[model samples]
Target: MNLESPKITLEKSATEAFNFLSDVQNFKKLMPENISKFEVLGEDKFLFALKGMPEIILKKKEVTPYSKIVLGAAGGKLDFSLIGNISEIETNQSTVQLTFEGDFNPMMSMMIKGPIGKFIETLVTNMKTAI
Candidate 1:
Protein backbone atom coordinates (compact mmCIF):
# COMPACT_ATOMS: atom_id res chain seq x y z
CA MET A 1 0.00 0.00 0.00
CA ASN A 2 1.10 3.56 -0.62
CA LEU A 3 -0.04 6.72 1.12
CA GLU A 4 1.05 10.28 0.48
CA SER A 5 0.72 13.35 2.63
CA PRO A 6 -0.45 16.73 1.42
CA LYS A 7 2.44 19.02 0.54
CA ILE A 8 3.13 21.72 3.07
CA THR A 9 5.25 24.84 2.78
CA LEU A 10 7.97 25.24 5.33
CA GLU A 11 9.69 28.32 6.62
CA LYS A 12 13.07 26.65 6.25
CA SER A 13 14.87 26.00 2.98
CA ALA A 14 14.92 22.51 1.52
CA THR A 15 18.45 21.95 2.71
CA GLU A 16 17.59 23.11 6.19
CA ALA A 17 14.56 20.83 6.42
CA PHE A 18 16.57 17.94 5.02
CA ASN A 19 19.30 18.47 7.57
CA PHE A 20 16.84 18.46 10.43
CA LEU A 21 15.08 15.31 9.25
CA SER A 22 18.27 13.41 8.49
CA ASP A 23 19.00 13.29 12.16
CA VAL A 24 16.89 10.66 13.89
CA GLN A 25 17.01 12.55 17.16
CA ASN A 26 15.16 15.48 15.68
CA PHE A 27 12.12 13.35 14.88
CA LYS A 28 10.88 13.63 18.43
CA LYS A 29 10.10 17.27 17.82
CA LEU A 30 7.81 16.35 14.94
CA MET A 31 5.94 13.46 16.56
CA PRO A 32 2.36 13.83 17.69
CA GLU A 33 1.60 14.90 21.22
CA ASN A 34 0.07 11.49 21.92
CA ILE A 35 3.35 9.68 21.37
CA SER A 36 3.79 7.23 24.21
CA LYS A 37 7.50 6.63 23.80
CA PHE A 38 10.45 7.91 21.77
CA GLU A 39 14.14 7.14 21.71
CA VAL A 40 17.08 7.70 19.45
CA LEU A 41 18.87 4.38 19.01
CA GLY A 42 21.84 5.80 17.15
CA GLU A 43 22.81 8.42 14.66
CA ASP A 44 20.73 6.76 11.96
CA LYS A 45 17.95 5.02 13.85
CA PHE A 46 15.15 5.75 16.26
CA LEU A 47 12.29 4.02 18.09
CA PHE A 48 8.86 5.37 18.84
CA ALA A 49 5.45 4.18 19.90
CA LEU A 50 2.05 5.78 19.60
CA LYS A 51 -0.65 5.30 22.19
CA GLY A 52 -2.25 2.26 20.58
CA MET A 53 0.50 0.90 18.41
CA PRO A 54 3.47 -1.31 19.00
CA GLU A 55 6.87 0.33 19.24
CA ILE A 56 8.42 0.89 15.84
CA ILE A 57 12.10 0.98 15.06
CA LEU A 58 13.22 2.89 11.99
CA LYS A 59 16.63 3.23 10.39
CA LYS A 60 17.73 5.72 7.83
CA LYS A 61 17.90 3.80 4.56
CA GLU A 62 18.97 6.45 2.04
CA VAL A 63 19.27 10.17 1.50
CA THR A 64 19.49 12.16 -1.70
CA PRO A 65 21.24 15.35 -0.71
CA TYR A 66 18.52 17.93 0.00
CA SER A 67 15.81 16.30 -2.03
CA LYS A 68 14.80 13.13 -0.21
CA ILE A 69 15.21 10.94 2.82
CA VAL A 70 14.06 7.35 3.12
CA LEU A 71 13.57 5.48 6.37
CA GLY A 72 12.75 1.82 6.65
CA ALA A 73 11.61 -0.44 9.39
CA ALA A 74 14.69 -1.83 11.14
CA GLY A 75 13.37 -5.23 12.23
CA GLY A 76 9.71 -5.88 12.62
CA LYS A 77 6.80 -7.97 11.51
CA LEU A 78 5.77 -5.10 9.28
CA ASP A 79 7.93 -4.09 6.35
CA PHE A 80 7.57 -0.48 5.38
CA SER A 81 9.32 2.68 4.33
CA LEU A 82 8.69 6.34 4.94
CA ILE A 83 9.99 8.90 2.47
CA GLY A 84 10.31 12.64 2.80
CA ASN A 85 10.45 14.66 -0.41
CA ILE A 86 11.61 18.26 -0.26
CA SER A 87 11.52 20.98 -2.89
CA GLU A 88 12.84 24.48 -2.59
CA ILE A 89 10.24 27.18 -3.22
CA GLU A 90 12.37 30.21 -2.37
CA THR A 91 15.75 31.04 -0.93
CA ASN A 92 14.51 30.44 2.58
CA GLN A 93 11.40 28.38 2.06
CA SER A 94 10.46 24.95 0.80
CA THR A 95 7.63 22.46 0.42
CA VAL A 96 7.63 18.95 1.84
CA GLN A 97 5.49 15.91 1.35
CA LEU A 98 5.73 12.46 2.95
CA THR A 99 5.02 9.07 1.48
CA PHE A 100 4.46 5.82 3.32
CA GLU A 101 4.76 2.49 1.56
CA GLY A 102 4.03 -0.75 3.31
CA ASP A 103 4.05 -4.39 2.33
CA PHE A 104 0.93 -5.84 3.85
CA ASN A 105 -1.73 -8.26 2.81
CA PRO A 106 -5.01 -6.80 1.60
CA MET A 107 -6.75 -7.66 4.83
CA MET A 108 -4.11 -6.02 6.93
CA SER A 109 -4.06 -2.97 4.71
CA MET A 110 -7.79 -2.56 5.02
CA MET A 111 -7.55 -2.85 8.78
CA ILE A 112 -4.85 -0.24 9.29
CA LYS A 113 -5.16 2.18 6.41
CA GLY A 114 -7.25 4.66 8.29
CA PRO A 115 -4.89 4.87 11.25
CA ILE A 116 -1.86 5.07 9.03
CA GLY A 117 -3.42 7.86 7.03
CA LYS A 118 -4.16 9.77 10.19
CA PHE A 119 -0.62 9.19 11.39
CA ILE A 120 0.83 10.59 8.17
CA GLU A 121 -1.42 13.61 8.34
CA THR A 122 -0.41 14.32 11.91
CA LEU A 123 3.26 14.14 11.05
CA VAL A 124 2.87 16.49 8.12
CA THR A 125 0.89 18.97 10.19
CA ASN A 126 3.54 18.95 12.87
CA MET A 127 6.22 19.80 10.33
CA LYS A 128 4.78 23.29 9.93
CA THR A 129 6.05 24.15 13.38
CA ALA A 130 8.62 21.47 14.08
CA ILE A 131 10.85 22.11 11.13
Candidate 2:
Protein backbone atom coordinates (compact mmCIF):
# COMPACT_ATOMS: atom_id res chain seq x y z
CA MET A 1 0.00 0.00 0.00
CA ASN A 2 1.10 3.53 -0.66
CA LEU A 3 -0.14 6.77 0.86
CA GLU A 4 0.99 10.29 0.16
CA SER A 5 0.47 13.46 2.12
CA PRO A 6 -0.61 16.78 0.67
CA LYS A 7 2.30 19.07 -0.02
CA ILE A 8 2.78 21.75 2.61
CA THR A 9 4.83 24.91 2.48
CA LEU A 10 7.19 25.63 5.35
CA GLU A 11 8.63 28.93 6.46
CA LYS A 12 12.14 27.53 6.67
CA SER A 13 14.50 26.79 3.84
CA ALA A 14 14.93 23.28 2.51
CA THR A 15 18.28 22.95 4.18
CA GLU A 16 16.90 24.12 7.47
CA ALA A 17 13.96 21.73 7.27
CA PHE A 18 16.21 18.87 6.30
CA ASN A 19 18.62 19.58 9.11
CA PHE A 20 15.85 19.69 11.67
CA LEU A 21 14.42 16.38 10.48
CA SER A 22 17.81 14.70 10.27
CA ASP A 23 18.10 14.57 14.00
CA VAL A 24 15.99 11.94 15.73
CA GLN A 25 15.48 14.11 18.79
CA ASN A 26 13.60 16.74 16.82
CA PHE A 27 10.91 14.36 15.57
CA LYS A 28 8.83 14.78 18.70
CA LYS A 29 7.92 18.24 17.55
CA LEU A 30 6.24 16.80 14.49
CA MET A 31 4.13 14.21 16.24
CA PRO A 32 0.45 14.65 16.94
CA GLU A 33 -0.74 15.85 20.31
CA ASN A 34 -2.27 12.43 20.90
CA ILE A 35 1.00 10.60 20.51
CA SER A 36 0.97 8.19 23.41
CA LYS A 37 4.70 7.58 23.55
CA PHE A 38 7.87 8.70 21.80
CA GLU A 39 11.46 7.81 22.59
CA VAL A 40 14.72 8.31 20.79
CA LEU A 41 16.67 5.08 20.73
CA GLY A 42 19.83 6.42 19.11
CA GLU A 43 21.07 8.89 16.58
CA ASP A 44 19.32 7.05 13.77
CA LYS A 45 16.42 5.30 15.39
CA PHE A 46 13.38 5.87 17.56
CA LEU A 47 10.36 4.14 19.04
CA PHE A 48 6.86 5.55 19.01
CA ALA A 49 3.35 4.49 19.79
CA LEU A 50 -0.01 6.04 19.07
CA LYS A 51 -3.02 5.82 21.29
CA GLY A 52 -4.55 2.68 19.81
CA MET A 53 -1.67 1.22 17.88
CA PRO A 54 1.19 -1.04 18.80
CA GLU A 55 4.65 0.37 19.31
CA ILE A 56 6.74 0.85 16.18
CA ILE A 57 10.47 1.20 15.86
CA LEU A 58 11.81 3.19 12.95
CA LYS A 59 15.35 3.85 11.84
CA LYS A 60 16.83 6.23 9.34
CA LYS A 61 17.32 4.12 6.24
CA GLU A 62 18.64 6.70 3.82
CA VAL A 63 19.20 10.39 3.37
CA THR A 64 19.64 12.46 0.24
CA PRO A 65 21.02 15.60 1.82
CA TYR A 66 18.45 18.38 1.54
CA SER A 67 16.23 16.49 -0.85
CA LYS A 68 14.85 13.53 0.99
CA ILE A 69 14.88 11.25 4.04
CA VAL A 70 13.71 7.67 4.20
CA LEU A 71 12.86 5.89 7.43
CA GLY A 72 12.04 2.20 7.65
CA ALA A 73 10.69 -0.07 10.28
CA ALA A 74 13.59 -1.52 12.29
CA GLY A 75 12.03 -4.87 13.08
CA GLY A 76 8.38 -5.57 13.38
CA LYS A 77 5.50 -7.52 11.91
CA LEU A 78 5.08 -4.81 9.32
CA ASP A 79 7.53 -3.85 6.64
CA PHE A 80 7.14 -0.18 5.78
CA SER A 81 8.92 3.00 4.94
CA LEU A 82 8.16 6.66 5.54
CA ILE A 83 9.73 9.06 3.10
CA GLY A 84 9.98 12.83 3.41
CA ASN A 85 10.54 14.89 0.30
CA ILE A 86 11.71 18.48 0.42
CA SER A 87 12.04 21.11 -2.26
CA GLU A 88 13.13 24.71 -2.04
CA ILE A 89 10.48 27.20 -3.06
CA GLU A 90 12.09 30.55 -2.21
CA THR A 91 15.02 32.06 -0.41
CA ASN A 92 13.78 30.95 2.97
CA GLN A 93 10.88 28.65 2.18
CA SER A 94 10.27 25.12 1.03
CA THR A 95 7.59 22.54 0.43
CA VAL A 96 7.38 19.12 2.07
CA GLN A 97 5.37 16.03 1.35
CA LEU A 98 5.44 12.64 3.04
CA THR A 99 4.86 9.21 1.60
CA PHE A 100 4.17 5.98 3.39
CA GLU A 101 4.75 2.64 1.72
CA GLY A 102 3.91 -0.64 3.34
CA ASP A 103 3.79 -4.32 2.54
CA PHE A 104 0.59 -5.69 3.94
CA ASN A 105 -2.02 -8.21 2.91
CA PRO A 106 -5.25 -6.93 1.47
CA MET A 107 -7.13 -7.56 4.68
CA MET A 108 -4.62 -5.75 6.78
CA SER A 109 -4.48 -2.86 4.39
CA MET A 110 -8.21 -2.51 4.48
CA MET A 111 -8.16 -2.46 8.25
CA ILE A 112 -5.47 0.18 8.52
CA LYS A 113 -6.26 2.39 5.53
CA GLY A 114 -8.36 4.86 7.47
CA PRO A 115 -6.22 5.26 10.55
CA ILE A 116 -2.96 5.32 8.66
CA GLY A 117 -4.31 7.90 6.24
CA LYS A 118 -5.38 10.08 9.13
CA PHE A 119 -2.02 9.59 10.75
CA ILE A 120 -0.20 10.82 7.68
CA GLU A 121 -2.55 13.78 7.33
CA THR A 122 -2.00 14.76 10.93
CA LEU A 123 1.75 14.61 10.50
CA VAL A 124 1.61 16.76 7.41
CA THR A 125 -0.69 19.30 9.01
CA ASN A 126 1.56 19.55 12.02
CA MET A 127 4.53 20.26 9.78
CA LYS A 128 3.18 23.75 9.00
CA THR A 129 4.20 24.81 12.52
CA ALA A 130 6.39 21.96 13.66
CA ILE A 131 9.07 22.42 11.05
- Which candidate wins on TM-score? 1
Error (Å) of candidate 2 at residue 22 is 0.7
List the candidate 2 regions with Cα displacement exceeding 4 Å. none
**Which residue pairs in candidate 2 have backbone atoms (N, alpha carbon, C) closer than 3 angstroms, thus clashing?**
none
Quote the lDDT for 7 in model 2: 91
Cand. 1 TM to true fold: 0.97
**Candidate 1: where is the Cα deviation over 4 Å?**
none
Leading candidate by lDDT = 1
Instruction: Provide the clashing-pair count of each candidate structure.
Output: 0, 0
- In model 1, state the lDDT of residue 113: 93
Residue pairs with clashing backbones, model 1: none
Q: How many residue pairs in model 1 have overlapping backbones?
A: 0
Q: Model 2 over residues 1-131: C-alpha lDDT tens digits? A: 99998898999999998998899888788887789999999999999998988999989999999989999999988999999999999989999899999989999999998888888788878878777
TM-score between candidate 2 and the true structure: 0.96
